[model samples]
Target: MWKRLLGFDPATMKVRTEILAGITTFLTMSYILAVNPAILSLTGMDKGAVFTATAVSSIIATLIMALWAKLPFALAPGMGLNAFFAFTVCLGMGNSWEFALTAVLIEGILFILLTLSNLREAIVNAIPMSLKNAIGAGIGLFIAFIGLQNAGIITSNDSTLVSLGNITSSSPLLALIGIVIVSVLLIRKVKGALLIGILVTTLIGIPMGVTNYRGILDWPPSVAPTFFKFDFSGIFTPQMGLTVFTLLFLDMFDTIGTLVGVSTRAGMMKDGKIPNAKQAFMADAVGTTLGAMLGTSTVSTYVESSSGVAQGGRSGMTALTVAAGFIIALLFSPLFLSIPGAATCPVLVLVGLFMLSPIKDIDLDDYSESIPSFICIITIPMAYSISDGIVLGLISYVLINLLCGKRKKLTLPMYIMALLFTLKYIL
Candidate 1:
């Protein structure tokens, strides 16, 4: 029954391991349940409704990944994509939140068409092996940076852009202690070290006054305010086209990068191609469409799934576990949200280290390959954008190889991607 439902292979994967992996992933990503509604609510949506919608949408999308795609990845309304939906399309462009949701709906439907055409999968396979390794390493650094910032271990600077935070402060101190605890457990080869570390740190934070323990159980918020709330009056405008294109562009490469980077780190790539690539894209497309209909932003595969993969989540059971977590979260949000960012931040930092291990495989002697790879590695964290890093890297790869007369190394998709990326910047 487990095998049929979640692709559980008894010889290779254990039920306990997959369950622990899923819990670990859920702890790390549960912040999205709070963060997404907070960001989207800025456009005047009801916070509680958005919260319910977030969980429902995540549950549906992640369930698809579990049963159909059969990969240990989770989907949610994405971080940056939500910011774009709320700030750029709604606030900046003076469009209503309903208008933005309509744009997302269009983008999601188009994503389904593109996935059916295999365009998204083609883009994934087109990335050379060297860049693929670099992407894994880059995502590592990117997630690590995110952890540090979230825990206040890294702070903003006016002149220099970023600087170290006060390590002695409550949040940063708790995170540092959690890192040491996790590191020690990891060194001792403890099973479920990541999940244990997060829980322990969260408990420790309660004493330190860092974690605020809200009451555990409550009725879930209604989805009425945001459900099927899209407005299509502005759908045919040029601005709507731009908005949909931007949403598609952002979700596509972000999903592509997460799919490639996480699969690469998990050693799930076979013959330099992701398994079940079509189904995976379909899961993501369905997630985005559903999320839009439910009154959220674009949904994409989260990079945090790497934490689960790091914990030996090899099958769809891990994703099924995540879906189960979200179902619980709908009612027990206060319990899950009680886990402060500082507690889970350490796990992301450690997982980042795990993701970076692939860097050793990149051949430094081949500058043509290595240079673009290096660009991708540095740009992810530096630019604080995965899609931007990939765009710059691919554009550089095509241009440098062409300039060096190494045309044989480039694929037709490579040329087309470079041209499209260039046009993205130009237009």
Candidate 2:
């Protein structure tokens, strides 16, 4: 596995290189295992159960990536999907945790069906290339915004716009320090720069009394595992099914965008098709369903998995290494919990920056592409929802195309996407 991932004969690689790659992959994805449970815990689910669900789902998803996708990519509960699970499905919809889990399960199953039926491909092909680039940039902006908000460097104002925070505040200052330091390191082409920046910022935060140290000193208490709590009772209802379907589709597109961005970076596309996309989608579907059964939200491939690729990961071995680390961390949740948000926030912000590099190449001459592209790219962080960005982007794309005398460029699937966006707006 090490040989496959590192492109070196396992018999010949320096032990240090192998260890370093493994550690890199682990650190890049460890946040998912920790964050998923923490986010779900907000829904008032049993903390112990949520943790167990996170571990189990991670294990299952990692196994799928290793065995099926066979790519250097780690899958986990997605950041956008978790927010949707928390803010949209659970809180906004006023749904019970069990109901939400049921929705996740149903969505997973539907996702599997969509992949098998070629619907996933249809949807992928339907999206304009420019829109895809915008989606990538938009997600990056969204993630960066999340980091800023978490660091108290940005705050909402009257639900219309977000404004900068008080720079005098310690948290914002620490976050600024982190951002500047990490950005500098990245510009210098430093390897493991993000991790270093995060550690440095976290250490600085500790001295400034911005981060709590109680969790570090107190040994983590072991919590018993509660697995397989599938609750399908409320999921079959019409309203419930629709909600689940919406969540599923939302996660599916989010995953699609990530896969496209990562695969493009890794040269994984052949004739605009990602090899084993079906299998990868299946893995995601199964992982999400399994996550729901285990008592967490939907699990999917993470965009941060691209960080491993950027660090020279070239095969499924990287994902396997990440998965192995997740499994070990599952047994030591307390250790992961000790890493405060301030520490991880820098990494997230840096990853967002790395992901935004593709924006430089997007063609802005064509209004059909450029307008929707700009809207999508800008709306993600501003709207605070990827799905909303996508929906609005697609709608704008169709409108722009019609107005630009390019209605002939509309394919069947594009029409369908536009219709779906319109219906979504109506509903």
| Model 1 root-mean-square deviation | 0.7
Model 2: per-residue Cα lDDT over 256-311, one tens digit each: 87777677655566666776777778878899887877777888877766656656
Per-model TM against the reference: 0.99, 0.86
What local distance difference test score does each model get?
0.94, 0.72
- Stretches > 4 Å off in candidate 2: 1-35, 42-44, 83-94, 214-226, 265-267
* Candidate 1 regions with alpha-carbon error over 4 angstroms: none
Best by TM-score: 1
